[model samples]
Target: MTERPTTTTNAGIPAPSDEFSQSVGPNGPLLLQDHYLIQKMAQFNRERVPERVVHAKGGGAYGVLQITEDVSQFTKAGLFQKGAETDLLLRFSTVAGELGSADSARDPRGFAIKLYTGQGNYDLVGNNTPIFFIRDPQKFSDFIHSQKRRADTHLRDNNMQWDFWTLSPESAHQVTFLMSDRGTPASWRHMNGYGSHTFLWYNADGAKFWVKYHFKTDQGIKNFTGAEADAMKSVDPDHHLRDLRTAIASGDHPAWTLQIQIMPFEDAAEYRFNPFDLTKVWPHGDYPPIDIGKLTLNRNPENYFAEIEQAAFDPANLVPGIGASPDKMLQGRLFSYPDTHRYRIGPNYLQLPVNRPKAPVHSYNKDGPMTYVNSGDPVYAPNSMGGPVADPELWKGESYAVAGEIIRSAYVLHPEDDDYGQPRTLWEKVLSDTDRAHLVANIVGHASAPEVTADMKVRVVEYWRNIAKDLGDHVAKGLAVNGS
Candidate 1:
């Protein structure tokens, strides 16, 4: 037989044996001289990176986004240029959970995407739902805390969640959705995605249009009831993730059709709802979705750690022609996302292969931890040496006039800011009779918990009364029937 080559340590030092570790007197204390054993153990100890504080439990896929229809009149972004095509990565996650949390939990599903466009990487950090619970960024930490387990008790408290919701009436709309069937999506592939915050777009003529993105799943919307979701928790903890992977592996590639609703900049003054409110949504009937492209997830990452785990996306990653809106929540996220990535990954995270922009990136930033690239000429701007120069003429982007005083004040909540219009619309118009019945049942079930005092239940009923009198009456009746 031919001789086999022996394995070696990381330093290219040949190993004497492959099966046994170097020990003193055969099974005594481990010898420090065993460099291979030491290296392996040390590396194993440091294998894990920091997990994300939110959206820790996630599933990702490699894909391509192809523009099927052109909207170049509304935006000059290269991704929307005629017949544009780009590589993409999509991640679906639960908003509140540890890495090992159940995939079928009743929480908002994160629908984030990284589009490697020719100009740069564009990230759409969105959610499966069209709206969120709170409008102000300051309330975010407190809201998340309420959703998490109590610090002292280390137990999930229905009281904590309801207490927060009852105090913040802004949460009623999303709370209604969360307590409905939509909260527990059957699978990530079967749900929709929305760029919940309003954004801005500019054309070649510098005309601006407020925009919202919607990704309707080709698989269609399917969700689980409260009982079904609870049962799924016990049956298969990773049901959604496994279902997505298995479907893709079996040649059933999941896809979402990209659509966008555009509103004229002039209409902000006359809109019924605050266009930038994270707690509300623009009626699709007013500004309907225009088909733009299709996003198809056809490939799986070869290495999860190198690709998915290292992937970073930020709302601040906007190119020329694509811009942000005055949405306060969106503004906060522009700073927060990149800041979190720097802390979780490193200052040079953008240079990582998974996050690096496909287009040439030239900036004044340099010399950080894990420095991967070397600027050949100079890192400073306005240099005499041959370096990247700014092109003002090429800066074709949105330009809007601002005439308001710069003051710290809440957004001008429109006449329809009563927090009941959309929820009532959803109940009466969007949902079927069966869905309405399930929604009432779900709300009543949650409110009937022993921890929820009669006063809290009465408050909840009164709150729902603002949305719908019948809904409030039915919920109260259900609570009474359950002997609340």
Candidate 2:
């Protein structure tokens, strides 16, 4: 027979008895001197930290990213070398949902990855879609508030959602995607992931290239129809989460093929559109994708709260050869991600076991809440104790000179830059006849809500007309709008 291990307090003291409370008698009042009982209750009360402001509900697994092709010419990052393998943690989430919201909600999924490389932790935070609703970071909060519940009613209002989307012309492309059946992914394993923002990849020779990342699912793309997703809410609110956990436990691990689109550093200056715009995508014909590696999630986390919930992914966690670009959303996130982690998980969140880097951490950052690690003497830099020093050469990346009075303005448009151009291509050239039909139906269902004003409905029609005449006509016909 196997021996059962004894239960202990967090401080490692053997618990006297966990089944009962210390009391004067079986029916008497409980004693305050019951330290073990108080300890258990107090710890349980504080078990949950504040949920994420955006991606509150999520699930993740440990995995290995195996490089199958050589991309050393584009990036000197060690993770890109052929045959190189890096361990990673991937969290799949719905953008608008609360911690307890249904997993099958019609929303864009957050595909955030944290790779533990030799240099340090590299976080690739992105969405399933290749483009976002807005390009500028200044409008991000308003955009999220519109999707979230109303301030007064505390209930989601379709009017607020449409009002924001119709007013912001740049939101056309992402809105078209959200109203389609593709919005409700069937399962995390069946959808594709993208590093939507453009990044700078530099090599050993100081050569620079602009890059975008796409992770195509090996299991194939699958989505639930609008009606099906609605039914799933009543049938099983946790359907997507349950599916992923069950599949992995049954040895049916999921995988994605990593592909990259590389653009020469000089091409952005004359490109048809502002390449840094988060609302735009680089046409495949212009910069074809190069298959680079495979990412397979084979290990399930032993403790969901400790391993997955506590995991922090920051865009600012860049390594030597990889660096940020001028994309406004990406740039804002570089500060926002770490800031949120510090607020949500405390100042020393990085020191948590899950967020800790595989590589040795040597820096001057010290002393905060939950400080566990010790830095022996010379806590500050420029010390005679021979502490670590920053190397400018080790962090060589692309740099360009810009001269102008600092002022607020939109991106300097290239010849082909316009809000509706790419969305037009997406509606006409990309979506099939069936997809177009579903897209229109989904729009009518959401926009025809009683709360949505007639004026807002007319504006919604105008928004689609800019994308394509047929899309506008279909929406108008469905809503019974006779040019009013």
Candidate 3:
């Protein structure tokens, strides 16, 4: 199976020798005229691509999504066709960390999946947690800046993070989840993945439904205690990444059950909660998830940089039957995600094998760096020379009626828009006593970090107190931050 032995330059010219570079004599000055050596040195100097702005540290694997049930009644997307199996890749990573940061850090994990379908590439870009820190896209840049290093000392300041969270009340629900044990998952295999925002699913009949995605792990949920996570950081920084590769390499393939909760198209208007709000979840009691398929990751990537590093996921990459909802964050992401990818991976990123669709792409966009193929077909539309033309009958997207003023203002108020309700409910009902204790400890530990200023600590306590009275008392006691 081995090819004949050969050494060549990047352009495939026969190399003189990889072992020794050409020189004037045995002990003379090195020759700069050796083009192959110069080529090698130049390529070596440009080996790395720009690191991702966020979710920098990650690992990915090849997998299959097998449809177990007939969800065609909900959507005409080919991947959801009953008994269909599609090739896919899922990448998991720690947010708010650099490429070399510890995987054991207590932060939300990015759960981005790209499904190669016959129609096109559909990406469900999500995270482990069902909620995010902020809803409006305007605050996204500032919020990320707070989590990242400071401008003055280049140090991560907990005060800056809390300051942003306290100022933005909507961060409570996600912050509560972040401080819980679930934040530090045992491995990428054990935690669940969620399409946190609500999406729109359209049937062949043109009937639409508001939907939410949940990928429950088959391995069952497992998480590390805060103390254990901190200790593991010192022992093995890439614990999660190592565990994933080792498990797959040993043939212990991991899997998740894909389930979605669908809401009637008209329900968005009359529901008690704003159905399009990313901060809220459609209660299972109201719209229970319907089991759809299974996802199994059986193959590890041969080259991490080629496959995983180059892999890009965007919320805007929707197919015919799958579309977006009016969720503000989802709307913002529909634009922002692809824009960042265009800058990071280039406009021709989809040409990369990892991100490209298995289906035939008849796009007029023809040129960019590293673009090797030209179809010889005409490039522009509305031409008599027979270019690719749109056929509305073949694949028409779902459309809805809209009647609203175009303005830059706050969200329309709902009866229960306050941030404290969900987190308070989570703290009071969902978490057990031990869970509550750990959550309090995590908050006190992080909120009381060395970088947290006294004023910021006061605001943090206020933020907690607003969530729940007893919860605030516990955090205050843990941090010894005095009265209201």
> TM-score of every model?
0.94, 0.97, 0.97
Q: Candidate 3: where are CA atoms >4 Å away?
A: 1-4, 394-397
**Model 2 per-residue lDDT tens digits across residues 1-484:** 9999999988998998979999988989999998999999999999999998898888989899999998888989998899999999999999988989999998999999999999999999988999999998999999999989998999999999999998899998898888887898899999999999999999988899999999999999898988999899899988887888888899999999999999999999899899999999999999999999999998888898998889999999888788899899999999999999999999999899999999998978888789998666788978889898888887776565557778788856698778899989989998889989999999999899889999888998888998998899999999887673
Clashing pairs in 2: none
Give lDDT tens digits, candidate 1, residues 180-232.
Answer: 89999999999999989888898888888899999999999999988999999
* Candidate 2 ranges with C-alpha deviation above 4 Å: none
The weakest ten consecutive residues by lDDT in model 3 span 390-399
What's the residue-level lDDT of 361 in candidate 3? Answer: 84
lDDT of candidates 1 onward, in order? 0.86, 0.91, 0.89
Q: Tens digits of per-residue lDDT for model 3 on 1-484?
A: 9898788887888999877888888878889998988999999997777888889999989999999999887888888899999999999999899999999899999999999989889999999988999888888889889899998999988888998999999899999999999999999999999999998888888778888999999999999999999999999998998999999999999999999999989988878767777777778999999999999999999999989999999888888888888888999989988888788878888888898889998877888877865555688887788777887643454778878889886665567667788899999999999999999999999987887888888888889999998899888888788996
- Residue-level lDDT for 393 in candidate 2: 88
Per-candidate alpha-carbon RMSD to the true structure: 2.4, 1.4, 1.6
- At residue 224, candidate 2 shows an lDDT of 90
| Alpha-carbon shift of residue 160 in model 1 (angstroms) | 0.9
Best by lDDT: 2
